[model samples]
Target: MAKSASSVDWLNRVFGDSKYSDLTIECGESTWHVHRVVICAQSPFFDKACSNGFKETSSKLIKLEDDDPTIVREMLRYLYTGDYLEQTKEGEEGSRRSALSTNVHIHTIADKYDIPALGDVAISKFSARAAREWKTEAFAGAIEEMYTSANENKEPMHKAAVAIAAENAKTLLNDDCGQAFRKIAEAVPKFAAELSIEIVNMKEKMPPTFARYRCPNSMRCNKVNMLEGLGQASGSRTCTYCSNQYYVNVWVSKKLDD
Candidate 1:
């Protein structure tokens, strides 16, 4: 463990050192001096771009016109340290939401570069950040961007964003963030359909309660006894209005006699 730690420290130092950097990555108007070996080790796209006979092989410069420089920096950090930097402050909700947005951007950059592992790391961080701030308008907007930018070949981030949106549909569809939800539905029909299906599935899987159940046909069933005698298990019921079947799981505890 100590050796591993020392190795990580050495790699971090090397990553920051400019003395041995052999390649330069230009993003937008900004430039980053980086090691070709380090980047190629993590990304096949870079490996090919930096290989012999390629234009970048002689010039030792690669231009990423579409990627943000800050995201590229984070990608380099992850390549060297095996971990990406987390900029969100603890106990600060706004900063945390911003961090989630940044993670999604980083994921996009990783996907663009064909670095699947880096994309996976970014998605993991994004998921953690979303768990903390999924109801925020910032997060909803980030999901919109993610779904919009995602292509057919790369869609894990889109799927993850849809899952987050579906899980928080009630809060996200409220007055404050309703427009963002509408935009997502309009821009990405497949994602919208998946979210709707997930919402219905979630409602069907909700635990049984005495409160009246709302049917898909816009009618309410006030059958309180439908769940009264059911024990701690899953069961199905048919809505009287739509005649559609729904499933519910109930957990009831029984007193133990000593």
Candidate 2:
């Protein structure tokens, strides 16, 4: 169920307000005043950090020096509001990270913090943004980040990039926009292998236009012929080489382009 407007307004009000805040999250030069009940409940990492025996338990502050400040801000926004805005402030777009890159980084941060829901949201947004910006430098950068930062086997972002490349193989692999993608593929062997596998799977699923059959009489009349439109039917065929009547079973399992 969706939060009521009043509840959303209350959460938004609490997000930045220092009133009743029990924790201070510091990332880069920025700091967020947040409630422990909200932040710690949503994030297992925060919960552990704020529990007994940790310095944060007494200091009431968690410093994320290694994380990007912008991505951290977005993650906090999602924790407070249940969603995040993708667009940066006007004019800041030129200096800030691309929306696609932001989503990829957000997914990584969410995964690190053990917030599966936030990770899911970030990956879904990454997929949609990738579909729209697959031809741009931003997409290439996101692909590089995803391939390098995402360590899981066949990660969702990896699958998303491969799917987009498979759908637009011609333009992405042959056109000018493909140069960066090609470079990334060259640098990253696992990405290239996954892309190759996805392309092969797509090809295998295509409807074949032709079939090849060799005569069953291998001893004397082993004849081969390319047949089309047979549509999985059996028929009597005459062997032109040996003049023998034989039943031919046809299965159109070969693609013409192959």
Candidate 3:
């Protein structure tokens, strides 16, 4: 009878670390959990994202507090049972050490748990410090590493590299990247010159369009019209009557030039 009861208990424990914990996560896709927290949702971290997606909601968390039973219990709840991590701010902790420890430990655990949003925030925070001191190589290497770990969103990686290139390229014009830009510019000098000129003038100079608007008689008629009819005898253009000419539509160029 005891063996049968034991067999029933084993059947009742359907496997997996099924823990009942409630928490709120603040990063990545922004999700709220009630009874159960599913794993492997979208993440904000894998990309070169600025915001790290993580925090604790069961009162404030202690820094590096993963060692604390309160923090560690929650961390394990997520790790073992595939639950979402808590997201809390700094002021929520009772002490500086606890708060800092909670963040450090929880964030480390988040990276291990594959919570990209939290990881991204951690990296971005760290990378910002590195980038401020002209750390191009470090930033570049970081971007390369981030690219592989990123999910569907690829904008962050491009943005990071482009931002670095834009700033670095200005003073780095003598470098390889600058040399490459120069080569591309050299390949299309006429195009570059055309782009450099006045926009309207360039349009007027096209093959099928009239380049100039000239007057036939500058002495007698103050008004001028040349494009009405040029070749045939009947192809004459009428002139506009200014304040001096009155309402008369004078046939200014009825005569063909030999």
What does candidate 1's lDDT look like per residue over 1-258, in tens digits? 112677678778887577888998887776778898778977889999998689999999999887666677778888877777656466733344467778777777777778778778878888877777776666767776676665333477766777777877887677665676666677778778878888888878887545333443334543323233334546666665556665644212221122
Best by TM-score: 2
How many clashing pairs per prediction, in order? 0, 0, 26
Candidate 3 to truth, TM = 0.25
lDDT of 3 by residue, 108-220 (tens): 54554456454354435433543463233344333333343323443443343344434554443456534543443345453224323433454455444221223445577
| lDDT score for candidate 1 against the true structure | 0.70
Quality of model 3 by C-alpha lDDT:
0.37
TM-score of 1: 0.71
lDDT (0 to 1) per candidate: 0.70, 0.79, 0.37
Q: If scored against the real structure, what TM-score would every candidate get? A: 0.71, 0.79, 0.25
Model 1 residue 145 CA deviation (Å) reads 0.6
Could you give candidate 2's per-residue lDDT for residues 19-135 as a string of tens digits?
A: 999999998788999999988888999999999789999999999988877778889999888888776886653237788888888888888888878888887898888888888
Q: Which is the winner by lDDT between candidate 1 and candidate 2?
A: 2
Ranking by TM-score: 2, 1, 3
